[model samples]
Target: MPVKATREQRVGWHAAHKAACGCRDIPASLRPDVIKLLRSRRKP
Candidate 1:
């Protein structure tokens, strides 16, 4: 059985994935989550 990923790990993985794939024009499936993560980061 596989363990689930933590929120931080998921965010880190998503960021890394975007970095490797280029962030300028992400696929629709990944776009929402990526934007949500970025928005979270920007919040003070």
Candidate 2:
């Protein structure tokens, strides 16, 4: 049987995705939009 990915592997994958997204620079004029969305969302 093929080996399955562990929980840590899954979490690390999502963490990498989030970090990649955070590195993207939001336009200064639109930063508030990003801030509002982040504030409204709960942590996973």
Candidate 3:
């Protein structure tokens, strides 16, 4: 991850990491936003 990643970048990296490696989860701070993003993408 970048040393000074933006909120979106941080969330995206964590999301991808969560998918590729089930070792860790996105931080609590970012979890809600990540879920919101995922839900939005699933919409028609």
Best by TM-score: 3
Candidate 3 weakest lDDT stretch, 10 residues = 34-43
lDDT of 2: 0.51
Clashing pairs in 1: none
- The candidate maximizing lDDT is 3
Instruction: List lDDT for all candidates, in order.
Output: 0.63, 0.51, 0.80
- How many Å off is the CA of 19 in candidate 3? 0.9
Error of 3 at 17 (Å): 0.4
Off by over 4 Å in 2: 1-20
**Model 3, stretches more than 4 Å misplaced?**
39-44
Worst 10 residues of 1 by lDDT: 1-10
Model 1, position 17, has a per-residue lDDT of 66
lDDT of 2 at 16: 47
In terms of TM-score, which candidate is stronger, 2 or 3? 3
Question: Where does candidate 2 clash, by residue pair?
Answer: none
Per-residue lDDT of model 1, residues 1-44, tens digit only:
11697655665567666666755565566667776777776647
Candidate order by TM-score, highest to lowest?
3, 1, 2
Cα lDDT, model 3, residue 16: 74
- Greater-TM-score candidate between 1 and 3: 3
Candidate 1, residue 4: the lDDT equals 94
